[model samples]
Target chain A: MLFKCLPPGAEIPGRFPGPVHARGKWFTIDIHCHVRSDKAAAMVEGNAAVSHWFLETAANEQSRRINRENGARTRLQGSSPEKRIEDMDRMGIEIQAISPAPRQTYYGADPDLGREASRAINDFIAEICGRYPDRFVGLGTVPFQAPELAVAELERLHKSLGFRGIEIMTHVAGEDLSAERFRKIFARCEELGLVVFMHPDGFTEAASPITILPM
Target chain B: MLFKCLPPGAPIPGRFPGPVHARGKWLTVDIHCHVLTPQAAEMVAGNAAATRHPREVYANERTREVNRQQAERNRIQSTSVEKRLEDMDRMGIDIQAISPSPNQTYYSADPELGIATARIVNDNLAEIVGRHPDRFTALGTVPFQAPDLAIAELDRLHKSLGFRGIEIATNVAGEDLSAERFRKIFARVEELGMLIFMHPTGFPEARRFADHYLVNVIGNPLDSTVAVHHLIFGGVLHAHPNLKLVIAHGGGYLPAYSGRIDHAASARPDCCEQIHRMPTEYLKQLYFDTIVFTHHQLEYLVDQYGADHVLMGTDYPADMGEVDPIGFVEGAAGLDDAERRAILGRNAARLLNIEIPAAAG
Candidate 1:
């Protein structure tokens, strides 16, 4: 069979498994998956609109199922290292390159708030990847509206946290991706060879339907 | 052997000639050309020492020199009606839909100054187009930063001055075109059935693009791209489905990269929160020009958006504009005779509702 779901460490029995070596098996990687941090969740918890919307949506249902299936272990929530590894094993994925969920970037917030939120998200992602060294890599988030701060965070993510790249929302507070304000960010990314993953946020309007979704 | 310079006013001339003919001939209209009105020139000259926006200031001697040369070329080519007509004849273009040069839009100015400048520019353009009604039609400028004033001027231009359309910049003082404040102006444009020609001026945040002419080469197209994305994702197009919006510079980079937007919208619910359809579907509703500078580029534009949506555009009177627009269209590989005719003039004629001469072939 081309696809199979095997338990982790099953291949080597008594020893920790190396790469899966079942006959005719191939290693697979999913690069676009997103992860959420508890700190990021707590920050948005006070926003009643987002919290209520999330509780009523399919996303919340999925989150509940993951938590329930993992026996309510705090570290086995959807974005937790333990949960990610368990899911990866079940799905036959060899590695997963995780990026901050777009909502966690918080680029629309005030500059200082945006910077602090981005740093926290980046730190959490780095820690998650650190725990599962061979099975995961992380991409950081930056507060692009503040280019100077964004560049600083970008460098710290690369040099200190060992992040491979950054994820950016399609627009920053209604400004286009091509706005001259972002040139420094682009230049720094080019210099650092950081892969830019452009993710879309809710459309430019505050009345966007997705605005109801939890951040 | 494939290219020929058609004689002016000649019927069935070897080259494509201007749309109007003494005898019957195929019409060729340049829809994307610009003219700098005398009023605009006077204002700029009068305001030379005024406080300048940081983006407008030249950063280095080399940058100043390059801009000076370009500005000189623009002054000579853009200001004189006779020179423009002669160039049109030389290029085998018959009619031109002239708009005030993008620089003259001047949305950066204070509301009163901007409104005054727009009126002067619009009147000057009206006068120029009036002199050669057979050879020219004009699009008006408005004080976009002041929405109320812009709507009033739009009504005046459409009713009194007989303009069929208005030209606008991509943004007004760093505000996106999709900002809620601009919705009324857009609704008016739609209600009045006025065509929109969106051109970009100096890009916001152009400090890095100060050197290498990157501002024009890269910045201009990026501005158009940004404008279109906002209009699409912000639900402007969704609300105004019949809006006859035309983007210059071959619809910028949007037509080429729209698939990425479509993919993003499909994969994420947030991206489609406003519009139900994909971004490319909205792009197809818009029109593009042939100012992309090369046959392959024009061909790609025609392919990405159908030939009927593509029109002949020469930045006109600017150094960067196509010098041989007819030749460029004639040389596009794989275009059939009908496709060539549509792109050259028929499409623009239909869009502007210009009556073709009965004798035209």
Candidate 2:
């Protein structure tokens, strides 16, 4: 049976996971969802200083509690592609446009470390999309603190991995997104038709209760 | 006959401006307006080599074009009090709390030059406001590059000239406003109970922003965001809880993105070394102006920050300012009469401590 809330003129695609909702008829797509690969989680775990900095400087009590719960769930649902697909199917979601969690953006890490983390995260995302082509599309992350490195990675993700876009935080190291230093990345994104998903990172100071909402 | 649109319970002030739809009985104050006095213009023009740094730092074809267009428009409208008054009347603005144009802050100049320029700008603003007290009030400029000089001038403006507030740039010679050296100025301003109008100068890091006029558009708000973050995380807000601060460009990206900061602080121990409260709580203590361009955005600001915290702002006389200040507020959905009144004028009036004439019984 078709979902009652489905919009008019819906058509179900033949390959839909279950019989109830047809692809064209009632499929739902969530454009702004996040995924956390085990490799990315390991990377965050290894970077204790940066993680501590984020927790100390960015997160508050409520966020800490939520992160503890979400962190546990992300380890299960975010890491295993099968589990993610299962969750999506249960929720009646057809496709999810997934990017790495905002905490994984890691613009504050050392430039080389940041690039390494981004590569690992982006590769993991690409692998998930490759495994479930119909169910998931991938967005990549880059070390925005180093603009040149970010642009270079953007090109790689677009050309090789086929990422549709890259995610960026609103500010880098307290520098505004409009700073001239980041022009090359913006220019490359414009030239490549790469979508830019602007997200906010935790505030720069180590002791505030302000952080961007997770998409 | 009474104005049809005035809300039923609104007090009919004895001497309000003539009726305008949805804005008849209340005073409409524009707290975020800018002015460029002729003397400050002449000073910047005459000091070509000194003033060239801001342009040269971002020398590009687009930057040149944007700067040229801004200079032309500002020369016309920003400098002329008569032009400003006419525009305010057209926009249905009753009082414009005019501050010197962001460029005139001149925080980058040598200490002496900065102080002299500030005095000239302040004197000109005083003269303009003095000429028409009912239509205008003014905020004085300070030589923030020199904090001692800035404090002295702040004292002079407050004591001698009766200025109610002081205008400052987001940064002082590339230093954030939250730096320790500037603490004295903040403390003094708090002690004086004077309003701090925090306006962004040209974004210090404008290299990527040269194209698309993003320098003013995105850059302005970003500057304010950075400044406020420093104030919050750096412990300025914690130290002086009663700063009476008003951030332009709707407090930049802070109000909307505050929840994230809270999350970061909670999950990490290192993020909370300065203050113990949620950043939004401190943010609530500060005020914002409604210059975000859309009614929905303004309404969101009002919702996020209560009506009392959001004041009416039109970047005044600049091309980027709200074209119809009154209509922008009136057009916003979900605002009741009292909310509209608060945002339109009452909030600003209360902040500035100006008494609106009560209605004649």
Candidate 3:
């Protein structure tokens, strides 16, 4: 039984746990997926910190235009929940662990605002998972740049919100993952036996790969 | 000593070690690099047997095509050896071990042709390295689809061609690395004490990620994930305990995620009977390359696998690759001098068994 991506509006052939119908189906885990709503994207876009980082890190003329455009739109974009569920249904994916899109990972300096935004996103993700318990699970976000706040949020998400894990980018700004500052979060995660989904927000210094829309 | 790419015809820096000036300086040994030639690309593209497999199994069509194009017109390729050497000189790279691009691993039905094609590419690589004895070395290629032919080529590379190591894809099509058919090859490699550079080709039926760019970006890691998982869970590593294998892309997300594997294994003892040891123990035995482009990742890789088990790599000539591999490791915070040295070059030396002349460093 192979795992395959089914076309949109395609009929699901059997039980979710039944043999995957996709070609060359490896183990049936969808480790990464994203969700976005227009309202949520707008709120993030309006944030001053996001706007500031967008300006500072936008290296080229084209990247600057993209950063400004995204900032103005104030909308989250990636895979819609409908599209995500459809894709999962097509691929015959048994479990889908969804997280905030990578843009949320790069929440620039304002730690207070970062925490506020993260709380909102976590609450939203939890709701989404609750709405579709069997089909979906969420990996929460915390204010990683601010270690103490990040740790506190991590505790709340795991102990209270019931998220299975937290999604963390490989680095914050230029800080390495193994830095002593990050050890606080790592220690907590190690003790809890929770998974940390480590991903990268494109090449840190280079703006070319991250900002520009792919051709 | 920051590493930077140079364009063609860039001035050969005065700082570079030339016949006139040789001095003690930062020593850079690039253990991972490749030479993609037009002949190699044609060999891969022309092979009907290789293309007979489903395209859905490919990681990224664009990445594959770009690589193929680069190989087809080596004359117009972005990463020219002249430019690479200039940049190496600027960055103080004293040595580089060139190997076949894993993209060229496709060889169809004819094992004999696969062997011949591998020899042709390897000989070309050997020639390039031979011309720059002071600054380069070659790792010979093998047609993994043909294990017997592969071993024979390995002997030839080690003996006649004087290559330092051999390179093979992590899995041949859907076959396990620990299967009986590959034991003879592994035994020969172990007997020769040669380092086997294990790189991931596209995942089996990897093309599904095509729409989202997941195959190359995500599927490649998953492929490595499955390969290493099998190596440990399938008891391949345990059977041939001494088989030295190096994985690319920071061991493809294995180090950070290994704890879950052991937890699952212990939790489901009945299901995981095939795996005997903790995943962490097996992880410690494997070597990972530093193509994972962040400092923290470098630290995590070193922390989880130990400094001596990490080596430097840059998937050169590919857009989806690191430009300054050594700098990335060096810049990693919390890494002391000893760990830094080990990951940058020393570990690769021990693994490849390259004897550094006392006068060089």
Worst 10 residues of 3 chain A by lDDT: A206-215
lDDT of 3 at B360: 46
Encode model 2's per-residue lDDT on B106-143: one tens digit a residue. Answer: 88788898889999999988898899998888889888
DockQ of all models, two decimals each: 0.04, 0.05, 0.02
Docking class of 3: incorrect
* Candidate ordering by TM-score (highest first): 2, 1, 3
Tell me how far the alpha carbon of residue A128 in candidate 1 is from the true structure, in angstroms, after superposition. 11
- Please write out the lDDT profile of model 1 over residues B1-361, one tens digit for every residue: 2114556554532222233323123578888888877666567565643224323562456766866766775676678888888777767778899998787887877788888888998898888889999899888999888999999999999999988898998877677787777888989999988889999875665655666566777778978887898888778898788888989989889887777787656544445656767678888899998888777878888887899999888887665676667767777877877888899889888888788876555
Query: What TM-score is obtained by chain A of candidate 1?
Result: 0.71
Write candidate 3's Cα lDDT for B58-161 as tens digits. 43566557546545544333336677677566555667777777755654447977887788888887887777777778887887788889989999988988
**What order do you get sorting by DockQ, best first?**
2, 1, 3
Q: For each candidate, what is the lDDT? A: 0.75, 0.76, 0.68
lDDT for model 2, please: 0.76
For model 3, the local distance difference test gives 0.68
Better of 1 and 3 by TM-score: 1
Higher-scoring candidate on DockQ, 2 or 3 = 2
Which of candidates 1 and 3 is the stronger one according to lDDT?
1
Interface RMSD of each: 14.2, 17.1, 19.0
